[model samples]
Target: MPELPEVETARRGLEPHLTGRRVIEVRLRRSDLRWPIAHEVRELLPGQRIAAVDRRAKYLLLATAAGSALVHLGMSGALRFLDAGLKPAMHDHYDLLLEDGRLLRYSDPRRFGCLLWQGPGTLHPLLRRLGPEPLGPGFHGDHLWQLARGRTLAVKAFLMDQSIVVGVGNIYAAEALHAAGIDPRRSAGRVSRARYAMLAATVRDILSYAIERGGTTLRDFINPDGQPGYFEQELNVYGREGQPCRRCNARIQCVQLGGRSTFYCPRCQR
Candidate 1:
């Protein structure tokens, strides 16, 4: 699945083309994705001007006066900006035809992506209870420390919680924890404030770097420009089990924590 950085990459690529552009055509090649494509999307999007293109967690928000469109690029979804002359291929599911004769195309080989709608002054349930954005100012050490208090969950699991911090998925969580020199197996409540502070900063730095590099593309992820992100080349411990650690030269280790793969350097992270 596309995490926050990957999703943000898509948002950045789409924002320039989508903002202020009127939707002259609404073409739905299929009626469903993950869930049914809401009827409001078909009816409200066309002729409405796209006020802004924003991202909350991994969802892409297309805003207009009439309504807002919420898009989730499920596991294998990729959005492409195609010329009007280009034809839709096998997995191309949704298209937002702009007055500028461009198509914001959504293609998901797995059909897990979604198109939903929201009305004015209302928040979608999927987005309502999400924690603060990891890249936002609200997500510093003190914030994470407070939420981590009295939690017995492993630090990796706690960090992955949506209510504690949104969008630090498995890949970035492992990378951030590794960067902070914190063991993924530590109890969340037992982690010191100092370590948490370092962890938070590491998370921000890693995520920002990934976004700058256009996000890590392990599989099936591409920016809206159809370019694969190169951040995967910079991973430290996520997929390098048994490899030498970059910092300590210790063997990178792996284990299953909370059913997700966890990786770290035993000698470096304590």
Candidate 2:
């Protein structure tokens, strides 16, 4: 599934092409994707001008006067901008016909993604309770530390909680924790405030750098232009299990935490 950086990249890539453009048509190849396509999508979207493209957590929003079209690119899903004359592929599920004769297409081999509607000025349920954006002002060490008090969950699991901080998924969580020198299995309540501060900084830095590098390379994820992300080459411990640690020359180890595989350097990440 696409995480924060990946979704942000898609938002950035789509914004230029979509902003101020008019949706001349709403073409739905099918009636559902992961969930049933909202009625407003077919009724309210056609002829609406796209005002902006924004992201919240891992969701993308196409804002317009009528409302916002909420999109979630689940595993193996992608959105692409293409000439309207081009033929649709087998997996192409929908398109937004633009006034300029271009189109924005959505395709998903697994059909796990979603297309929902959010009425103007109202928050969708999927987004209402989400924690602060990891890259936003509301997130910090103090925030994580405050909510983590008395929580017995593993620190890694706590960090991955959407209510604690949105978009710190498995890949970035492992990298951030490794960078902060925190073991994934440490009790969340036992982590020191100073260490939490360090973890928060690392999380911000890693996320910013990953967004700059076009997000981590994953089999199901590709940029709007169909390019693979370049950040995978720079990862320290996320997928380097049994490999020599770049910092301490120790073997990188892997363990399952919260049912997800976690990689860390035993010597470097205390």
Candidate 3:
């Protein structure tokens, strides 16, 4: 699945071509992706002028006068900007034809992506209760400390909670925790404020760096231009189990935490 940085990269790649452009055509190649494509999307999308392209968490918001088109690029989804004449591939499932003759195509092999609508003043359920954006001001050390006060969940599990903070997925969570020198299995409520502060900073730094590098491409992730991300080359311990740690030279270890694979350096992290 595309994490926040990958999704943000897609948003950045699409904004220049999408903003201020009028949607001349909208085609839903199938009726559903993850869930049924909403009727409002087919009815109100065409002829609407794109006011802005924004991202909340991992979802891209295409703002228009009538409503906002909400897009979530699930596991294998890729959105590409192509010339109007380019032929659609086998997985190409939807297209938005712009007045400028550019076509924004959505392709998903797993069909887990989503296209939904949100009217003015109405928040979609998936987005309504999400915690603050990890890259935003609202997600500081104090915020994490407060939410973590009484939770017995492992730190890794707590950090992955969408209600505590959004977009710190499995990859970034492991990276950030390793960088902060906090063990993933530590009890969340027992973590100190000072350590939480360190964790918060590492989270921001890791995410910012990944976004700058266009996100980590493990599999099936590409920028809107079809370029694979280069950040994977710089990974510390996310997938280097049984290898020497770059910082401490200790054998990197892997475990299953919260049903997700977790990698860490025993000596370097806690």
Residues 168-187 of candidate 3: C-alpha lDDT, one tens digit per residue: 88899999999999999999
Leading candidate by TM-score? 3
Cα lDDT, model 3, residue 111: 93
- CA RMSD of each candidate after superposition: 1.3, 1.2, 1.1
lDDT for each residue of candidate 1 in 97-212, tens digit (9 for 90 to 100)? 98999889999988888999999788999998899998998899989899999999999999999888898899999999999988999999999999999999999999999999
Where model 1 places Cα greater than 4 Å from the true spot, the runs are none
Candidate 2, residues 75-94, lDDT tens digits: the string is: 77899888898999889999
Which prediction has more favorable lDDT, 2 or 3?
Answer: 3
Candidate 3 residue 144 C-alpha distance from true site, Å: 0.7
lDDT, candidate 1, at 195:
92
Local error of candidate 2 at 8, Å? 0.8
* Model 1 poorest 10 in a row by lDDT: 24-33
Superposed Cα deviation of residue 111, candidate 3 (Å)? 1.9
- The per-prediction tally of clashing pairs is 0, 0, 0
Model 3 scores worst on lDDT over the 10 consecutive residues at: 24-33
Best candidate (score: lDDT): 1
